[model samples]
Target chain A: MTFDVEIVRWHAVASWTWNAGDDVCGICRMPFDGCPPDGKYPGDDSPVVWGVCGHAFHLQCIQKWLQSQAQTDQRCPFCRRAWEFKAAAPSS
Target chain B: MIKLFSVKEKQKKDAAAINNPKQSAGELRMQKDMSELNLAKGTTISFPDGKDKLLHFEIFLKPEDGIYKAGTFHFDFQVPTSYPHEPPKIKCKTKVFHPNIDLDGNICLNILREDWKPVLSINSIIYGLQFLFLDPNPEDPLNKEAAEMLANNKAKFESQVQAAIQRGAYIGSNHFPPCR
Candidate 1:
């Protein structure tokens, strides 16, 4: 005869934020969890790429920016340092 | 008289800011950057497309001293979704006779080009723009005539800047808009 609400489940959903712990891509400013500038879902088609500067961005986002800076030279959008992609993860 | 909105008013204003229903991550970052903006003296920021479009905005720089004293210059800033990483596109909406700023509003600042790093904030870009007005750089010349005048003849450059201000005069066939 009594309505009692029991608090049982509690969890935090974190968007894959960049190195600064923010949920947005530093260049594109779009969330890593959502659709990228290329309008692709976050998965193998749109994986996240990490820079040596510890900044992370949606693969599509960084690739597009790198293309624009190709004639000038590739530089990290965050630190302006030479953009060195992190070592690739082993595909098994 | 313009009054800055209070927190209560800001919340109400923000409620009307979600034009796309869902606020994008870039918009959130821009909001943070704007709220924490520490602009130099005599500079002001205005949103031309209301508050919904945070990515596009304008900044007005009115330097109190130096070469650009008493002149009001407007710059249009377009922040891409990939902000912080990619520098905001800056253009001199108000034409002026300067070495760094060309007639078509192309800026020759290094930070806007190869020097752009994600670490650089919106504040840094504003400071850079203000510096251009205060001390027009003659080394990296966008307007060759203006740069030549600045580097070779300081007095002539000063006179030209002054002359161009009052009566919308021509600076080497390029007419500057009167923005006093």
Candidate 2:
């Protein structure tokens, strides 16, 4: 007697979600799991970063937004408050 | 082998999507934002293009304090397809004697220009516009004469503001349409 093994593809929906209820990144209006425009997947690039204001965005989106801002008004684009990272590691 | 697997995946996705057509990411976000809009007192929102066209709408601000008190002003908000990333283009449809707002209906607001962020909702923009009526910023004004008048003579500025509220009050030469 012989036995055969059957393989199946399993799918899971992982939301790059924050404490906030929004499923999409507020900056890019793109789904958290999906990559930003002209972006690659499953890498250090364009990962989600959370602000101290409890808002979250794509790392690349916030970086580009912050660069164009003046020093006096260097704040999060979403809440119009001072930009503070929830996780210190994301800043580096 | 890869091509065959990709075709099979596409077919699976198509079958899954057939039951319910997907809305663009922008539409879903807009829906969420619109549903959560918390308009202030004396402020009302209207959509001329029906409920389906969420991108175009008008905000009526009846500033009940300061110089603009009791004056009804209409503002047009046009949200682009690339919203959240891009700020909405806002314009004053009701011409009033305002330093930050011009005769051509262009407004000088930081959020509408360089300072806009994705986190800002329609409620924030409405408040910004209302703040202009309560305290018009002469420091950064779109109307030079209005700014100058507001800076030089407080009495004259008050008079001018009153005159502007009157039906068809002429400021020097140009006529301001009577706002109801």
Candidate 3:
């Protein structure tokens, strides 16, 4: 096919989402792409975190969830098992 | 044809929405939980203050099996602003001969007190309430007399439960309501 118009300037667009099992955070009930009630930004400010139990929640949401419980009784919100972070944090 | 007033109306609505603002985190989460709430078999929920009031509601559990079968138990739920973080305050509205439920409607469920976690939703509470009817835990109980009876004499406990459900009977000093 012959090109009718010459290409001068092109702008590329990209999109992304959290690679988590659930679409919405269980704690804040907000979408992973959206920020929590206390957060301002989505991908930058609010990050999705995973537990050793394989449940995913926003970093801020999970932190708040953990802080609500006593230190001795701290456990995963999804499962009653002790909560352990899957990794340090996402690169995003 | 282009609509001229639509933009103005939308702007007015947006302004009103901004004035009202979004619901609090707890309310939002509660709304989500209520929407996704999967009540156990023979369990139903009702909101006395209408749907807008999601924090306060009632659950009616009618266990189809176990000792509490064919009985309708009413439980009142008052969810706090720190819900999920703090478990909802649940009270048994229907008086029954239960070891875990006291005469004053106070319940003795571990999840409602110590084991509550943010991941646990209203569905979890409903299931827990239903389980209490199926298996009344005498190990951790609010009614000491009922607990002792349940632990010591299984036949006596079953008969007492049946009497309480069938005809408002008095076991000890408290009178139970005939709920079926």
Candidate 4:
């Protein structure tokens, strides 16, 4: 697949610049940095992943998006890529 | 050199934990739900990105036998942190002519609105959207003229739908972007 340099750079900058302080949840546009003491980050410490050619969001966030689909064959809601979750790394 | 190595190893360990199987509650529930999705024949889903990121995705709808038959439509869905309790925001990326869809690609689907329930799954919404094309309800109209035409004159409504699908402009005051 072809990559758009500008788009990639933009998202790269976005990912780096995200301090969780200014980081907004891609789904709700809510701030993710240091959420309320009681409230939690949706994915715990899981790194937020952006679709190759699309916007960024947490893995859990995207998983929720997929689950919301009425059909089981639903793919990613942004780029239409098949949604697959990575297996948990084996513990040492 | 010893200190630097230790720091690097720590960071790697931290990263591993973050990507571990013990996900948050929200993520666990989401996983369970996604594994159970059952889409229709012409519909497909994509991640745009790989499996690492999960926030943004796309849904493609190809209506085989409706006013929108032979046409393809795409919708983008963004899921927020407080899911299940909140509905994902969906936008039609493909501009199409329909009484329920505006020029800006804002869909007038009930599932995305007041009718939404926490129990409603993604499969329900997709079917609801597909049903909209198969049967456009003129009662809760988004495009007033189209609704009125469909309500008052069925023949004119069908013709208008055909014209719009064929890339011809309708008689409405607002002009639609070509979907063909």
lDDT of 4 by residue, B14-52 (tens): 999788864444444355456767888888988787554
lDDT of each: 0.77, 0.77, 0.85, 0.64
- Candidate 1 per-residue lDDT, tens place, A60-81, comes to 7777778867666887777677
Model 2 RMSD in Å is: 9.8
Query: Which ten contiguous residues of candidate 4 chain B have the minimum total lDDT?
Result: B23-32
lDDT of 3 by residue, A1-92 (tens): 88799889999999988887578887877898998777988897898888887788898988988787778976777777788889754455
Instruction: Show pairs that collide, candidate 1.
Output: A27-B82, A27-B83, A28-B81, A28-B82, A29-B81, A77-B118, A78-B118
Q: If you superpose only chain B onto the true chain B, what TM-score does each candidate give?
A: 0.85, 0.84, 0.87, 0.77
Sort order, DockQ high to low: 3, 2, 1, 4
**Candidate 4 ranges beyond 4 A from true positions:** A1-92, B1-26, B167-180
> What tier of docking accuracy does candidate 4 attain?
incorrect
Worst 10 residues of 3 chain B by lDDT: B1-10
Name every residue pair that clashes in candidate 3: none
Supply the global lDDT for candidate 4. Answer: 0.64
Q: Write the per-residue lDDT of candidate 3 for residues B93-172, one digit (tens) a residue.
A: 99888889988999998889877777788988888888888889999788889999999998999999898999878999
Number of the candidate with higher lDDT, 2 or 4: 2
What is candidate 3's DockQ?
0.60
The positional error of residue A92 in candidate 4, measured at the CA in angstroms, is: 44
* Reference-based lDDT, residue B77, model 4: 77
**lDDT value, residue A38 of candidate 2:** 38
* Alpha-carbon RMSD of each model: 9.0, 9.8, 4.9, 19.6
lDDT tens string, model 2, A1-92? 88796768878887442333567776666676666553577345657778888777778777767776776777877667798778643332
Per-residue C-alpha lDDT of model 1 across residues B46-135, encoded as one tens digit per residue: 999997689999999998888778888989999977675578899998888888988888999988987776556788899888888888
- On DockQ, the leading prediction is 3
